[model samples]
Target: MSGWVAVAGLGPGADELVTPEVMQALAEATDLIGYFPYVARVADRPGLVRHGSDNRVELERAAHALELAAAGKQVVVASSGDPGVFAMASALFEALEAGPAEWRLLDIRILPGITAMLAAAARAGSPLGHDFCAINLSDNLKPWALIERRLRLAAQADFAMAFYNPRSKARPEGFARALDILRQECGPDRLILFARAVSTPEEELRVVRLGDAGAEMADMRTMVILGSSHSRLIERPGSPILYTPRWTE
Candidate 1:
C-alpha cells in the first residue's frame, strides 16, 4: 500500500469546534504527529500513535511524520488552529526533499480548521470583513527587517492585522516593534484587540489602543489584532465588542 499523509487541524480543542470532516480524518489516522501542547489537547484520543515534539523541532517533526507515512502508517500530522496558515503544512512541504521521493510522491492532504485569528475575530466581533493580513512576530524564521516590511505594507494598505506567535523569550521586542509601526502609520487612536488563549478555558479578550498593546501584556499564547480605521466598538445591551469594515456601500 502506498503511503499517504493527512495534515489535519483539530480546531480549538472544544469537541464542538472540531468539524465532522476533521473528526473523520482523525479517526482514520493510524499515527498522529504534532507539537506537544497540541498533542496534549487531543491526549484522550484513542487507537493512534502520537509523536509529540518541542516547538523548535518542526523540521524533525515533519521528517518523522513523512518517515512513518513512508513505512505505510496512515499518518495524521495535526496542528492546532489551521495547518495551512503558518503551521505544519508549510514545514511538511519544505521538508519534502528531506524524505524519500515516494513518500513525497503520494498525495498529501491539508484539511482546514478554525484558525486562532478567525476564532478570536468572531468572539471579539469582525475585524477582517474587508482586506486583511496576518503576520507572525516570531523573528526566528524570518528576519525582523522582512517582518517590518510586511507590517509597513499591511499598515499602509489599511489591512486589519492578525498577529501570531507574537512573542517568545528570545525575541521580546517583536510585537512592540509591530505595534510601533502600526501606531506610526494609523495613529494612536487605532484599536488593538488582544485575544489570549482563545477558545480555551484560559481565554481572555481585550480591546486596547495600538500604543498600549505591548509585550508586557502578551505572550506566545496571544493573538493580537490591529483594526483598521473603519473598525468600531459597538455596545448592545448584552454585548460590547469591536467590529470592522462597514461594507454597506
Candidate 2:
C-alpha cells in the first residue's frame, strides 16, 4: 500500500481463482482500474476506489492507472483473465514507457492467474495432449498476415492451438479463414474445441472438426482449441477436460 501498483489477474469469476496474494493486494489497494464488467466482479469489497472504463478506452484507462500509481497511490490494475494474455498489463506498461520517468521509480508487479485457455482446456478433456500454442486472431492490433503466418506454422508443426479473440463484429469471417488454413496444414480430421464465456453463467463448450467450425459457433467471448495430430478424444462417464504436456512421456 505504499509505493507503485500491483497489476493482477482475477482469473475468471470463481472466488477460488483469486490467490491469497492477489486478495491481499486488492485489500491493500487504494485505487483499482479495469474494464467495467471486470471491475463489477469485485465491487462488494469495501474501501477500494475503482476507475471502470469501456473496452474502447484502453489508452485512457492505462493512462489513468499510471497517473494514480505515479501519484503514490496503491493501485491494482485488474484484468479478469491472466494479465499477460491479451490483458491490461501490457497496455499499462506501454503507456508508462511513452509517458514520463515518474513511473520508472514506482514498484510494478505482475501476478499470474488462470488464463481462459487453461480453463477451457481443463473443461474440454485433453484437447492439447502434446505440443501446443496460443494465437489471438483479432486483427484490431495485429494484422491478419501475422495471424495467418502463425496459424500456418502451428498447423504445420502439428501443435495444438488455443485461439483467443477468434472473432469480432467487424471480422466475422476471421475464424472461418483460420479454420481453412488450419485444415490445409493439419487436415480436416483435426478437432476444434470451442469454449465460450468459461467460468461464467453463460458458459458453453463444444468439440467439432476443423472443417465444421463456422460463424454460428464463435464470437468475441469464445476460446477455441484446435487439437494437434497427436491429440485424441477421451470418452468418460461425466464431463471432459483437455491436457497438453510440456514433454511426451
Candidate 3:
C-alpha cells in the first residue's frame, strides 16, 4: 500500500519537549487519530483530517488507524509522552496482531518523546539517576492485587520507582493504599518526590519523607517518584535536590 501509520508521542505537555521527528510525522500525516486531548495538540490545517476519540476506546482507535492506513491514508496516532512507554504504541501493535494479514504489510513507525517519568525526574533533580523502574498506579487494565504486588517487589528490590496515574477521582483510595504499602515496606524515612505538570506553566514539585507524603499530593497529572534505600537529598538554599547515588554501598 502507499499509506503508512505512525504512532507519535506528543511528549510531556510542553510544546518544546516534543521532538522534531514527531512534528515531522504529524506534518506529513493526512489523518491524525488519538484520544481527544492529544489530537487537539496538533493545530488544524488544510488537508489534515483529525480523528479524535475518547480515551477508553484504544482498541477501536487503533483498528480505525489500521483500516485507514490499509486504505491508503497516511495516519498518525497521537499519544501523550513516549508512545512506546505505556501509551498508544502497544495498543496499536495489539490491534495489528489481531487484524488481517494484509495489515501487517503496512508501514508502521513509532516516534519517541520525553516521557512524564523522565520529565518529573529532571524537575526533581534526577531521582532516577540510578537503577529505577516505572509502574502505572492506575488499575484500570490490571488488577489492584497485581499493582500491590509489583509495588512491594519494586521496593524490596531497591529500585527508585516512578509512578504514573498516581491518583484519580474514580480510584482515589488506591493511592492512599499504595502509600500505606510503601510506608510499610520502605519505612517512614524514605524519600518521595511529587512532580505535577512538569515543563508546563502549572508545574509544581514537592519532596518529602514517606511518612509525610499524603495521597492528596498526587492526582492523575502528578508523577510520583519513590526513592530507593539509597536515594537522598542535598539541601542548600532553594528546593532540596533529590537524587539517587550512582554507587550505593
Please report the candidate that would top TM-score against the real structure: 3
lDDT of each: 0.83, 0.81, 0.94
Off by over 4 Å in 1: 43-46, 237-239
Candidate 2 structure quality by residue, lDDT tens digits, 192-247: 88899888888898888777767679888889898877666666766554455456
**TM-scores, each model vs. reference:** 0.94, 0.92, 0.98
Clash total of candidate 2:
6
- Backbone clash total for model 3 is 0
- Model 1 clash count equals 0
lDDT of 3 by residue, 122-212 (tens): 8888799999999988899999999999999998899999999999999989999999999999999999999998988999999999999
- The C-alpha local distance difference test score for the whole of candidate 2 amounts to 0.81
lDDT per residue (tens digit) for residues 1-249 in model 1: 656788888776576777787788778888888888887777556778887889888888998888888788888888988899989999998899766677657668999999989999998999877778998888878888999999888888888899898888888877777778788889988988888888888998888887666667788888888898788888787657898866734
Q: At residue 135, what lDDT does model 2 achieve?
A: 85
